[model samples]
Target chain A: MVLSQKLHEAFKGTVERITSHRTVSAFKEKGVLSVTEFIIAGDNLVSKCPTWSWESGEPSKRKPYLPAEKQFLITRNVPCLRRAASVEEEYEAAGGEVLLDNEDNDGWLATHGKPRETKEDEEDNLPSMDSLEIGKKNSIQSIPSYFGGEEDEDIPDMAEYEEPDNLIETDPATLQSTYLVAHEPDDDNILRTRTYDVSITYDKYYQTPRVWLTGYDESRMLLRPELVLEDVSQDHARKTVTIEDHPHLPGKHASVHPCRHGAVMKKIIDVLMSRGVEPEVDKYLFLFLKFVASVIPTIEYDYTMDFDLGSSSR
Target chain B: MADASEKKPILQFAPFQSVVDEGFWHRLSSLKLNKLGIDDSPVPISGFYAPCSHAQVSNHLTLLSESLPTEASEQAACTSSVSLGNRNKCSVPGTIYNTNTLEGYHALDKQSLLKAEAKKIWDDIHSGKALEDSAALSRFLIISFADLKKWNFYYWFAFPALVLEPAATLVGIKPASQWLSPEEAEYLSAACREWRNSNLTADVPFFLVSIASDSSATIRHLKDWEACKGNGHKLLFGFYDPCHLPHNPGWPLRNYLTLIFIKWNIRRIHFLCYRENRGFADMGLSLVGEALISVPEVWKDLNSVPNAVGWEYNMGKKGSKCVNLAKAMDPTKLAIAAA
Candidate 1:
C-alpha cells in the first residue's frame, strides 16, 4: 500500500483514540476536562515513557537540555499595564474630594422663621389678567412689579445670595500645570518580557524547513544582532545559526541553519503515510507537535487546544 | 595644547536665560510640596531654559555612532564618507560652526541656540571628539530643565539612562530606539494577516487590521472592517502604534479609537495593541464593549471575556482585576446594566 494510505489509516486511528468515549471518561475521572489540561498531563506521561529522550546537545550528558524557564513560555497575551496608573491614584491625582463626614443639616426652618405662604394664597396673589397680558408682551416690564410689589417686604437683600470667594478652597497643587514624561521606568516588567516571531520556510538548498527567529525585546522593539545573541544557545549561535539582515524585516534576525528538521519531518510523514494518512498542509503543525512530543515533551506548541470545544460552530 | 592632533574638541555650553517669572517658580516649588508632601527647595533663578526639542539630531548621532569606527579607523571612515553613499551625504557638514556668520554667538532666541549647541554636542560625541562629555552634558540638560520648571521632560530623558546605566555599560552601547520602524510595521501587519487567515474558519472569520501612523492606513482598515460588519464574522482590530516614545501610546491609541468609534458607531471592538518588531512584547488584547466616545480609564480584560479562551490559562497569579467586558455587557447582570 502507498505511504499516504498507511498514514491516513494511522491518523484515523489516533483521532479515534483521542476522541473516544472511554478516553474522555478516563480523562474526566482524572479531573482533566480541557484539551490544555490533557496536553499538560500528556507532557508528564510522555516524560516517563522509556522511548522518549532529549536528542540534542551532548550525548555523554544525562540531561543536557536546559529546563524551560517560566519567562520563555508563550502562554497568553496579557494587557501591557506598564505605565497604567491605578484608577484610585488617578482620581486622587485629579483632586477628587471624598466627603468623609456627612452631617445632615435642617437649617431651612431657622432661615425662614415664619411658616411659608400656602400654595393657594401664592396662586391667588399671582398677576391678574391685565398685568399677565402686559407681562407676556414685555417680560422685562414684569421684573419691577415683583421687586416692589406685595412680596417686596419678604425679599431679602441680594448680598445674602452672593457666593463667598473661598466657598470651597482648592489646593494650589491641584491647579498646577502638570506635564507628562516621555517614558517611565517599566516597573511592571512588561518591557523586559520577550516574544519571538518564529517562521519556518523551505530552504531549497538543503530541502528543509529552516527556522528563523525574529526576537522582540521587552519593549517590543526588534532585537538587534547583539540582542539576538542572548536568546540563542552558544553552540547553535556559533555553528548552526547566522544573524543577518532580514529580507522582509528591516532589522537583523537570526536564522537557524538547516539541520535534521527536514529528514525528521520526512520520516514522520512516511510513517503517517504508511498508516494511511493523506498529504495535508494543514496537518503539518499537528504532526510536528506529535513528532516533537517524544523529544521535547514539555514544549507547549499546540494552539488548537485553546479553541472552545463547546463553541464548535466557530 | 601640547599636541594639536591629540587636542580635545572645545565644548560650549548655552548661556543661562530665565524666561518664566521667579514667582511662578516659587508657586511650582510650593505646589510640589502640596502634592507629594515633600518640601523641595525653590529652583535657582540663574539657570538656562531648554525647550522641548525634536529627536532628529539624536537619531542621526545614533546612526553615525553605529556605522563609523573610532580610533585607528577614524581617518578611513572620514575618507569613505564620500563612498558611504547618498545617506551619509546629508549628515556631513562643511564645518562644525558657521564661521562666516555670527549665528552661534549672537542668536537671541535662546531655545533655538541651545538646541543647536545640543546637536553639536551629540555630533561631537558620535565623532569620538568629546567621549567623556556625556555625563557633564546630561547634568547640564537636567539642571537647565529643572530651573525652567520642566522637570517632566528632564525625568523622561534622564531616567532611562540612569536606570539602564549598568546594562548599558555591559553592552557598550546606548539603548536601541524603542519605536517600530515602518518596515517592521509592514512585516508585522503581513505576519498578523497571514496568521489570522490560516487560523480562520468559516464560523470564525477573524479579521486582522493593522493600524499605523498613517491616517490613510487606518481609514483603509476601517473600510475593510465595515465590509465585514453583519457578516457574522467577528472583527479583530490589530492596532500597531509606531510611536515608541514614552507616554505616547495612551494618547495616540485614545485618539485613533475615538475617531473610529465615532465615525463607525462601533458599539464593541476587540483590539490587540502592540509595538512593531517586538513580536508580542508589551502587546495587550482588550475588548471595549461600549461606543467609546472618550477613552475609558481601563479597557476590558481579554481573559475575563467569554469565548476568549486562549489567554485564560496564562492569567497572572494575582488574577486580573480589569473590568470584564463579558460581565459588563450582559443585560442579566444588574451591576453593569446599561444606564
Candidate 2:
C-alpha cells in the first residue's frame, strides 16, 4: 500500500529518533557511508564507494587465522562423573587391554605374548573360547582378595587367547582412503543429507526477530521440536525454551528466545561507538543477523549472506 | 533593532548543533536573529556542554527519587540540596543566569545535576525494578535519545530495554520521542524519488500481495495468488490487519513489517482489510512505503501502477474491492467506517 504523507513522516521521524549519532560519525571517520545513506544512495552508488574498514583493522590482519585442529577435546562425549567400582569392572571386562596406549604400541602385547608373524596365522593357532564367559571370569579375578597371595600369576592369559590384530592400522594412506570412502557420493551418504532451512519472521508479540529452523533428519523427514532440541547448545536449550506451533508451517516448531540478540547487537554497536561511528537503527538488524550466522552456519538466513562489506552494498 | 520587548534573546546553547562551523552560525544569526529584532550575535564556538530541556531534567529528578534505593535516595537528597541551592541561585527557566558576573551566566550546574540524576535513574532502572513497574520501564525507553553525540550513551539506553524486558510488554511502549529534522526529511524524500526511478527501469517484475486475516481460507487464497503471480517476478506480501493474527503482539508490527520488506527487497504492497479498517491501512502504508523511502530502492522499475494497493473486504459478500492507493486514500472506504 502507498504510504500517506503523514504516515511516511511519522516513520521517518521514528527512524531519525532511533539513528545513533555516534555510529554515523564512526562510519564517516572510517571513510564509509552510513547504512541508511548506503540504502538511500541505491546499491549502484554504494557499490562505487570505498568499503568500510573495521577500527581494529581488516579482519584478515586482526589476527592470524589458526586452522582448526583435526583432533581436539570432545567435551560433549566426556563423562563428568563415574563410579570407581563400575569403572574398575569395565576395565577388567576388557581383559586388562583398556589401559593399552595407541593401538600402534605393542608394549601391552609384549608383556602378554611374543608378536606373531601375521594376524591370520595367530588367529588360526588360538583356541576359540566363549568370550562372554571369559569376560565374566576376568571381572571376578580383577578384584584383589583380602588374603593376598600370588594372585597376579594365577590370573588366566585372557589377552593372548582373545583375537589378535583387533587394532586397525592408522597409516596416512589408509586414513585418507577411509575419509574418501566416508565422503563418497553413495546413496546412503546422499540419504543422510544435513540441511537447515532458516526463515526470519517478526513475532508481533515480542517485537523481536523470530528465527525458525526447519531441519531435515537423516531420513529426510521434518524434524520435531524434541529432535531439534538436540541440535541446540545444551546451555541455550535449558533456558526458557518453548515449542510453539509454527505460524506458517505445518506443525509445532522450536522458537529460540532472542534474549541474547540485543546484547550481541549492542556489542557490535559498542565497537562502532569506540571507533566514533554512529550506525542507523535499520542497519543494526542486518549486522546482527550476520554476526549470528557465524554461530549457526548450517541455517541459511535471508539478507545475511547478501550483505557485502567489501563492496559497501548488497 | 527596535521593539526589544517583542523578541526574547535565546541565551541557551544548543550543544548538539554547536559543533557546526562558524559560517553556519553566522548564517543562522543573520537569517533568524535579524528577523526577530534581536542582536545577530554568533553562537559561541566552545565551552558549551550537552544541553538538557526542562522536561528531561524534571523527569530525571522524579525518576531518580522514586526508583533509587533508600540509602541512595538519602545520599541523593544530601547532594540534591546542594544542587537545589545552585539551581535557585540561577532561577532563569532555560538559561543559567549568574548574579556574580555577566559572563558567569552558564547552565553548567543544571547540566551536571541533570547528568547525575540521569545516571542514578539509569542505574536504578537496570537494577531490576524496571521490569516490575510499567512506569519505570517506559522511563527506560525514554532514555534512548537521538541528540546524544556519544553513540555509547544511546547503546546503553537501548540495551536493557530491548533485551531484558518481556517481549509482550516491550512492544506496547514507543521507544523514542524525537522527530526527524527538516533536513533529514528532505533527504529521505529525495532518496525515495531516486529509489522509485531506479526500480521503474529494472528488468524484474514486482507483485503486491494483500493479507487480511489469518484463517485457513485466507492462507489458501494467498497460496492461490502466489501460484498465479509468483512465476517469474518476485512477490512482495503486505497485510491489512496483521494484528488479527492469533499470536500477534500488536505493537512493533510496523517496524517488523518494514524490516521484512527491506530484507526481501520487496517492490510494492497491498494493504488489505475490510472497508472501514483505516488503522490497518495507515500502518501498512507507513511501513511498506514511507519507511522504505529512506533506504535503498527494492523495486526494479516504476512502470507498475498503484504501488500501494488498498483492498477493502466485504464481510457479508465474502469479496474484496481493490483500489489504487497511488490515486488517493479515502478513509471513508476503510473497514472502520462501516461500523
Candidate 3:
C-alpha cells in the first residue's frame, strides 16, 4: 500500500520487461538497490530508471527538480518545470520551485519559471552555457514573439512551460576567454556554426578533508586536474569540431572529486536516495559484487578500503 | 581644433581587445573602423593589459600568468601566459573543404593516427601491460595535454568504453532512442556516476546542438535532454540533431517535441559567436516545419538551397556519393517497404 513499495514494484516490473542484465532485486542481497523518491505535493518522481542523466532522478522533489537542461519532456504533459538560465538563481533566491506562469484553457500549461508572454526581447534569447531553448528550431533571431508560441495547443495535457528569464551575472572577459565563439557566418549573417573550447585544470594533490575516514564510508581521492571543452560546430556551421575531450567535463581546481575525498559518501548517498535508489542496498551490492569479482585476482583488496564505489563489497 | 588631443594620442583599450589585433585597434582607435562599428563587441575582463608603448603594439610581449589552473601554486611551470601574435591569414586549411563526413571531421591536431595508437594502448592494457596503479597512470596522462591533443588520444582514454560496454553505451546518447546494449548499458551506468558528479545536464548541449529562437524553447528542449542524459542508460543525445533525425521514436525524444516558437521581424540569420551565444540560423527563421534534413545532406545537394553556402543533409538520396557525413535513419519513420 505504501507509495515507495508501489514504486519499488513498478520499477521491478519495468526492469524485468526491458533489461536482460542483473536487476536491483537480484543484487538486493548485496544491499545496493534501494529506492528513494521526492514527493512534491502529489506527483511521485519514480527514479529507479537506470539512466545516467539528470533526468534519472525523482521529479517530485522540490530542491533539485532536474534543472531545465534536464526536464523529462519538452511537452506540457510532464510539467517538471525549470527557470530560464538568467533568472534561475533569482527565482531560487525567492524560494520558487515551479514557474506557474504559462496559462491556457487548461488553466495553467506548465510552470517553467518564466512569465509566459511574447518572445519579444532579443536579449532574452542570447546563448550562454546556462541558457535553454524555446523549441528545436535552432535559429535565435527567427524565433517569433510569443505569437505562435502557444503552438503546443495540439497536446491537451502539455502545460506549455512559458519561456524563462536569462540569468544576468556574466563576465564579458570570461565569456571570450572560454574560447567559445564562431569564426564563420551564414549568407545572411545568422550564426550557422559555433565552436566552443573551455579548459580548467586543477592541482595534482586533490584530497578532501570532509568525510575524512568514516570506517564505513566508501570514499577515495582525486589527484589530477582536467581539460574539458564542448563545441557545437554543427553541420550548418561548415566548420571543423575541435572538442575532442567533450565529455570529460573537467572543472578548475575549486571542484570536488570523491576519491580525493570531497563530499562524504553519505552526502552523495543522500543525493542518490533523492534520485530513487535506497543507499543501504546500493552500498551492500557494491561491497558484495567487489567480493564476488575478486575471486581469481592475484591479490584481493584489503576489505578495509573500498576504492571502486561500484563494487557491492565496498 | 582637437588636433592637440590627437597628437598626444591617449590610448584607450579596444572594446573587443581580446579579439582585435593591433591593426584592428589601430584601425578602430584612428576612427577608421569605429566609423562602421556597432556597440556589439565584447567588453574586457579584469587584469586586462593595454599597450605599454604605442610603438610596441605589433610586437607581442611574453608575460607569464601567476594564475595556475588550480590554487595559486609555487610551481611556475604550471602558470601559463601566451603572448599572442597578430592574426595570421592562413587561408582556412584545405581540410576545411575536404572534411565532408564524420570520419573526416577536422581535428585541431591531425598529424598522427590516433585510432592506431589507441588500439595498441588498449591491447597493452588488456594484456596487463598497463600500469596497475590507476592514480599514477592518470597522473602521467594529465601532464601531457598537448600530446593527447596531438595524437587524437581520446581513443587512448576511451578504451574504457570498449572494455566497459555499458558505460560506452552511454557515451554518445541519442535522445529518445531505443534501449542500449548490455555493454553500453553498463558503460552508461558507470558514466552516470561521473555525469551526476559533474552535474551534467542534457539540455546544456555545448558540444553539438541545434540553435533555437527563444530561451523558453531552448530551456524546454534542454530540460528534456537533461532528464534523459542523467539516466545511466542514455547515450548519444539527440535534441533534433539537425543532421540526423528524420522523425520520431528515434529523433528528438521529447515525445511531444513541437514547434513552440513563431517567426518574428528576424530578417536574416546571425551566427552570434562571441561569448554570448554561438550557433547557426536561417536567414529569417523561415525554415520551421519542413522535412528533417542534415546540413551535410544539404551541402551535398548543392542545388538544395539557393544560398552560397550550400546546406544539405548528411545522408542523401539513392545513388548519391558520400560527400557529407553519415547518419542512420529510423526505419520506423523513414523506412519504405517495397510494395
- Which numbered prediction scores highest in lDDT against the true structure? 1
Winner of 1 and 2 under lDDT: 1
What DockQ was computed for model 1? 0.02
Among all windows of 10 consecutive residues in model 2 chain B, the one with the lowest summed lDDT is: B150-159
Query: Candidate 1: misplaced stretches above 4 Å?
Result: A1-191, A233-237, A244-252, A271-282, A285-314, B1-253, B256-285, B289-339
Which candidate would rank higher by TM-score, 1 or 2?
1
* Superposition TM-score, candidate 2 onto the true structure: 0.22
TM-scores for candidates 1 onward, in order: 0.26, 0.22, 0.18
Cα distance off (Å), candidate 1, residue A227: 3.6
Put down candidate 1 lDDT per residue, A1-314, tens digits, no spaces.
23553465467446634552222322212211223332343343223221111111111111111221100111111112211112223333333222211211445543332223243234334423323342233223121121122322422232332223422222211111111112323322112223344433323233333445554333222233444444444434545566533322222346665455555566655555566655343334344445433332222223232212222111
Q: Of the candidates numbered 1 and 3, which has the greater lDDT value? A: 1
Interface RMSD for candidates 1 onward, in order: 28.8, 38.5, 26.6
What is model 3's DockQ versus the real complex? Answer: 0.01
On residues B192-279, what C-alpha lDDT tens digit does candidate 2 reach at each position?
2232224231101112332222211111122244353544432223222112211121111222233233334432332221100110
Per residue, candidate 3 scores C-alpha lDDT tens digits across B1-339 of 222222221111111111111111111222212232233121211111111111101111111111112122233232132211111110000001112122332231221222222333334333333222111111100000111111111111110111110100111122211233334333333332232223223112111122222211111222243443333431232221211111111111111111111011111111111010011111111111211111222222213221110111111110111100000111331122101
Per-model lDDT: 0.27, 0.26, 0.20
